[model samples]
Target chain A: MARTQGSHSEITGPRVREAAMRLFARHGFAAVSMRQIATEVGVQAGALYNYTPDKQSLLFDLMREHMDALLDAWQQEDPGGTDARARLEAFTRFHIRFNTRRADAVFVSYMELRNLTGENFAAVTELRRIYETRLEEILRAGQDAGVFTLAEPRITAMAVIALLTGVNTWYRDAGRLKLDEVETLYWDMVRRLVGG
Target chain B: MARTQGSHSEITGPRVREAAMRLFARHGFAAVSMRQIATEVGVQAGALYNYTPDKQSLLFDLMREHMDALLDAWQQEDPGGTDARARLEAFTRFHIRFNTRRADAVFVSYMELRNLTGENFAAVTELRRIYETRLEEILRAGQDAGVFTLAEPRITAMAVIALLTGVNTWYRDAGRLKLDEVETLYWDMVRRLVGG
Candidate 1:
């Protein structure tokens, strides 16, 4: 029986990505070399190439996967057929929870966009726009339905996202506030910001 | 006549700092080299040491100077005899104006903190804490005076700062909204966030 492509890659692909994300987040994309990533993964550089074509591809893949997972996770958490206020609440809680769990991915996604190739950068930016549009749509729905009172959905979306993602900087598992409590505090501010 | 240390350094010091900031912003701090910085400053690598002790010192100095300037600038902007609402409004406007003007310094300040030496990191973090404390104090006064109704002044301060600094990410001089207009919109959201 011949070996399948899946067998060879399934075992190594994830390790390669994990190592790449760690290195990229720690030392940054431009400073990190493929050899360092391979060493981190405990594989030869050639073996690492078998998983990713190059460092740029690895970075693009990590970021793309992060955005894809975020969108997918939000879809699962979207609570369809709900009111705008309820949906907005879901987004607030969901973004903080999802982002805090994947700190490295979140950091790399924000920090390394400048290092991506033009096409890759566009692709990543479009994915980000899709995520932003999801929030904007919710805000727009709220504004139209008279449940939210923000004038500019686009700028409001950006502000809300920034506010929520900022939690990753100071949040600690053993810290003063539990995650749920933190969520409540943030949601209160978010609701107030939009004049709910 | 011997050259005075003050005269030679006054000319080169600012240039060296400028070159380092540009390189650090363009590339990750770890990826930047003293040689590259020296070249950018149009000085020999040996001559670069005359301006700064080492690359770490340069990074530390740049970050420290940025924070110092920020604190100094805010002090000048502070409304000493105003009510909490008036002072809060001043801070909101002042932060956005100051941060946007030094986008490169702001970028490096946030992005390169992980590369700072432990003591250097602590010094920078203390500066950040002082700045955060300033905002928190305003929020506290507002709450005490029954002018603002936020529950957590500390978290609110962090969130507001994040929201304002986020303007750096997407703002363009030629964009539709003027700076004052941007400040107004942010101030509106901010005032609402604090339930004023």
Candidate 2:
């Protein structure tokens, strides 16, 4: 029975996640209760339990999935042949693309992180650290190649991430600039930041 | 008797706000109850009624004050005889200074803003818009004066605001870089973003 329930929940998981992500992003994880999420998802609160063990687990699953996808997307790119500037461009493009489409997810990923605890918090934070460390590694490589002039590659990477992630908080498909235009603008800033 | 109670409540208003901000920021507005805030503040739950008419008012007041102080701080700066770059310098400095000192309030201002209602929500949002519009004006001046080469002044302004406001999320007093150093690092990024 447990296996059947788990399998059935897996089938409806994405729908539950989508509904929860919107509510969590809109109301915040701490403010939103499971019943509200179920209502939003067009299910009874009890039926929602068939999807996730609890509200916190539901939030954690969305964030975990987002991070995994982000890492996978970045990893799949063959930035090997790209020079420092080109690689930076790829990073900027990917950063903007992933963040823009996942505004609610990104908002929860960035802000509701504190709602996670113990092992869950550690796992999420570790993924975030790994992602940030990858950017720092790129900055380090660029500096090693004598192409970037940043004084502190690590902090600069953090600043860039902060700025790039900032895109999600405000970007709208209907907003003033197209995604390409915003990417170009960010690229300009990144290029100038390290004197590329 | 009610007038004396009101005056007494006035004295505790800021303390109540402090309690509410901390709780709302830590546990989120929906998760925290009046009893919790009262317990945190060493007052009876009923006594909190002497100050905040409701939990939403407490949050609204905090958000409003944070935005107002931010606006007031920017206005106090004498941007006279300053070019776009110099004004940008002052802007970065002020942003870091204010956000670092009141990270909680700043976080509440950004994160819990949706909690406000009716007139309160509109008022807080208007103040925030005023600040962003002012920054855009400065960026536009920079572009017109040929000191900046951004494609869109307004979009660039939003990015800068995002980059700076994001500092409050990760900044800590014990962090390796001092506040002054962090401010300079961000100021450099802002300068480069505008082709300075």
Candidate 3:
């Protein structure tokens, strides 16, 4: 019963997450069943208990994992660099890449957070706010440095996030638009958003 | 069964739609049972068929009605006759007003269309495309007339829609941010986006 997908002896966690992500995306979070996810993972419904406490945990697990990966990817791609324009572009590329590549995860990350319980929801909420705040701070720094021209950094940040997230709603893995092309369009828009 | 929440005559059409709106927004379109909607409307499950032939029809009926009202509001407000910036501002205000007033209907209108089937889906799809295209044409006209400055009119229109739609994910009937305040913030961002 102890299973982790890539770990030494555990395959349960990742498998359950994979099943949950697919179901949650295709059907909204509240509609999906634990039994359905268990079936998809090739485990009995009871076997899923070893991996998650309940459906809400399964939902949070997918969301938190995606956010962690997102933050990690950003940091790994640009470790300890704080140039505003560069950071903005990096953020643009990272968002487009991660969001487009993981459409289900990104969709659930945005739409299903409300389903999480008090503490679980709090953690995800705080992390998301921190990510957004850092982006705004970078924009403000750019404004001060005279590299980015923007009005209302916080509003612009929210607009950028909304615009970038829209990419996932229509972007198909094999869609006509390349991820880089989409990324470029957003960068252009955000640059303009910030008066770049 | 009949409903008269506002200026409606009977509970059948409006009542069915009202119930569907709440259920769809709460549980989503695909997950809500026709029987449940019937119960919410105070009618026998079979009697609900008098108004809508099926669940998809019930869903599409509410969507088309919402969009129709939205289009009517835009026209009644004389959104078209104004200058580019005014027209854009009209759009910002109209969007917030419609979505806020009919929160449940607007939620389903934006998020639950894919659940519609056959002619029901096509009708909603075409109307939606037509509405969005109207915005795109405005941006294009503004850009061509030199009143607006946007690198890409089509993308700008879509981004504006995204910003407006993002309102539903967080809006409350009574929140720290009032609808007018949110509309103002969006208007500013939209003007910046369209180079107003």
Maximum-lDDT candidate: 1
Lowest lDDT sum, 10 consecutive residues, model 2 chain B, at B1-10
For all candidates, what are the clash counts?
0, 0, 9
Each candidate's DockQ: 0.79, 0.66, 0.45
The CA-based lDDT of model 3 is what?
A: 0.76
| Candidate scoring better on lDDT of 2 and 3 | 2
On TM-score, the candidate that comes out on top is 1
Collision pairs in model 1: none
- TM-score, chain A only, candidate 1, equals 0.94
Tens-place lDDT per residue, model 3, B104-163, is 776677667667777887888788777788889888888888888877566667777877
Ranked by DockQ from best down, the candidates are 1, 2, 3
Candidate numbers, best TM-score first, in rank order? 1, 2, 3
DockQ of 3: 0.45
- lDDT per residue for candidate 2 within B48-160, as digits (tens), equals 88777888878888888888888988899838454977887888898888888997787777777667787888898889788888888888878888898777777678788
Ranking by lDDT: 1, 2, 3
Question: Per-residue lDDT for B141 in model 2?
Answer: 79
Overall lDDT per candidate, in order of appearance: 0.90, 0.81, 0.76
Q: In model 3, where do residues sit more than 4 Å from their true spots?
A: A1-11, A78-82, A149-151, A173-176, B1-10, B171-178
**Superposed model 1: Cα runs more than 4 Å off:** A1-11, B1-11
Cα lDDT of candidate 1 equals 0.90
